[model samples]
Target: MSDTRNAPHVDMLRSPLGRVRGLGSAHRGAVTWWGHMLTSISLVPLTLWFIWSMVGLVGASREEVALWLTRPVPLALMLLLLVATFYHMKHGLETVVEDYVHAAAPKFALLLAIKGISILLGLLCIISVLRLGL
Candidate 1:
């Protein structure tokens, strides 16, 4: 055991040049993080609107519900809700897969599936809403 307690931190072992050269965020992390944050923030109001609208339509007949959906504002908001929900879900699952799934092959497959399925579901929802509205 050394005395005087003057040991330098491990990070101090690297030169400034070495520190600068080391692997950083690769710049994509912030973009993904910000996207996740924005989607989540947008979801709050969108989700509330969806729930409230659905509550109002609870006792409505199929034709009545369809009639309500035909409105432009409701249709647009529904499309936005689907897009933001799927986008948010994709990013959340991707972060989980990246953090925990160390195997490269599985991680790649999961990420690809996440993106594909998110897009597919979002598009399907948009199409359904369009069919009802238009």
Candidate 2:
């Protein structure tokens, strides 16, 4: 029921790809994606090892568990697990915040909080393990 004679050309509203090439490119997309994939892949083996270790220690007394942790390999692996877990967690939360939170200030604040909390918790966990193991 509307007149089309005076309408603007459809092509006028469409941008040519050449003209818009790098306008909105965030250069870090590939790095972030790679980080996500690597973390997820690393988590599989680390998580499995943690589960297997815990299962093996199910009936162990506190001292037995501590003694097992005191071994160099166990202590190192535990540290690696904690690091990978926290880094993965932080990366995931940052992605969520970047995707969902559009506002600049709030997005930045959320990212800062996520990083701060993740580091704090990771350090606490590492310290706990060290205390128990060493």
Candidate 3:
């Protein structure tokens, strides 16, 4: 029972119960951290592929771009990139809001808005990609 009152940094105010339980109430543990890292790593390759693909599309007509996307591999890869990106973005934004937004109401509102917009726009993009394949 060292005095938390005299603790220099002030973050040492955990209850004995909190210290013992380890996971505490929030309980995300390493999973969220690992997911964030994995998504970050995955984005590197996807982003590079996207940049190259766009560069190739630069001088092309819309019909040529559409034709390129109509291939099975390109269509699949694009969908995977979109899904991973939107999922990663949602988690990252949620983490930012959770860490920075102190007010509960605003945190909840921002999280809700983020999830909603991510899903809506992601679906629209996926649909657009699919249409190009068609």
User: Which lDDT tens digits does candidate 3 get at residues 1-134?
Assistant: 77777666755545676767755455645456677788788889988988988898899998998999999988887998898899898988998998899998998999999999999999999999999897
Error of 1 at 87 (Å): 0.9
Off by over 4 Å in 3: 1-25
Candidate 1 lDDT over residue span 1-134, tens digit each: 66746875464544566456653343243456678889889999999999999999988998997899899899888888888898899988887898899999998999999999988988888888888899
Give the TM-score of each candidate: 0.76, 0.72, 0.75
- What global local distance difference test value does model 3 have? 0.85
Candidate 3 residue 84 C-alpha distance from true site, Å: 1.0
Query: Which tens-of-lDDT digit does each residue in 33-71 have in candidate 2?
Result: 667788789889889999999999988999998899899
Clashing residue pairs, candidate 2?
none
Least accurate stretch of 10 residues (summed lDDT) in model 3?
Answer: 22-31
Name the runs in model 2 displaced over 4 angstroms: 1-24, 27-29, 59-61
Cand. 2 TM to true fold:
0.72
At residue 112, give the lDDT of candidate 3.
99
In candidate 3, how many clashes are counted?
0
lDDT per prediction? 0.83, 0.85, 0.85
